[model samples]
Target: MYPISTPSHAKLLRPSALPLHDRGGGARTVALVSPALGATTFISGITEFDPGTEIPFHSHNCEESVVLFEGDAVMDIDGREYALQPLDTTFIPANVVHRFRNVSHSKPMKILWTYASPQATRTLRDNGEIRAVALEHGKQ
Candidate 1:
């Protein structure tokens, strides 16, 4: 077996999946870190929010936790809005509506997010669409 880390060294995490997000502003994504296979736990690397950027409203089929690192933003979950700042943590349950926006004039917001399942993190990123939003919001 190939050794990963030493007994005293911390384990390393690296992700090998990429998803599409063509919303607003510049959305550059880095897998940052994730293990190849996890038995029952999921981890996040570093997800950044560009200035004046907002992820459209959507929900996951699994539980997710997000911790904000810097800049200003807001998270709307289940018809409730929560202002976000550095070091803030929020939880969003399965199948509950949620969205995030960076309303800051300057500085980018970084969120160290976590999901209960491996595929949950990419659900919103890969599946969200504008045509459906317009239909759901009755703007069409």
Candidate 2:
């Protein structure tokens, strides 16, 4: 176990410092920053999508919460689309198929993602059709 720290001992990190996985077409992700810094119970990171880029439909076993920090986001949850703007937060239950896309033509969309598990697992949908966006480094 790692030693618990006081609030003053909290660590600050930039998204670039974390392990970034390319999802192709300018979509990228960071992972495990929480546990890497001794956090327990949950893990968190960031995902950035460039204009005209998106993540393929997938489902995770763990619940997810995301906060849009920049630009515009169009989230397709269970086949329904929701438009998200800055500071908007969304919660997704486990085992739900969802995807995210950047709606802006010239701006990038960035979101902070948090998962209940340290290593969130996602199953990508493969239905004999080519995927527009690949998985992030072939991972969840």
Candidate 3:
């Protein structure tokens, strides 16, 4: 038997309609599907990286998957670098150190990402600072 609200209606979300958040180091994020949007199992979003910019090395509490949406990128996983093209996808396990860098000097790069857990947390490798993935877009 299903609960009264067990079957929720599907939602149509447009990236252009969502809010863009600064993630420092020339990176910005746009949260798409999440608990705030009634998602119960996982969370998804898109991240845009400015030209010649990269995010700091960090790991998540759960597995993560990312697909390159535009431009070229270099994904560093566990200290090894892998070149990525548009539509290239990667599945990263939990607690693995990784980061992404835009290889182009003029064009920006974008990636669509999803976390295995709804309540995911990230820990920076440099200072061990922890933060909730859901709240990432809420901060300046």
Per-residue lDDT of candidate 1, residues 1-140 (tens digit): 22245576545444334442333354444443234423235645555777887876777667878888787989987567889878888888877778778888687877776667544533354465423221221112
- In model 2, what lDDT does residue 14 have? 57
Best lDDT goes to which candidate?
3
Judge candidate 1 at residue 51 and give its lDDT. 83
Collision pairs in model 3: none
RMSD to true structure for each model, in Å: 8.2, 5.2, 4.7
Residues 3-104, model 2: lDDT tens digits: 344598776665555567876678877653455566666777788888878877887778989899999899998668999989999899977889888989
Specify the poorest-scoring 10-residue window by lDDT in model 2.
130-139
For model 1, where is the 10-residue window of minimal lDDT?
131-140
Clashes (N, CA, C under 3 Å) per candidate: 1, 0, 0
In order, candidate lDDTs are 0.60, 0.73, 0.88
lDDT of 3 by residue, 36-128 (tens): 667878899899999999888999999999999998899998768999989999999999999999999999999999999888999999999
In model 2, what is the error at residue 116, expressed in angstroms?
0.6
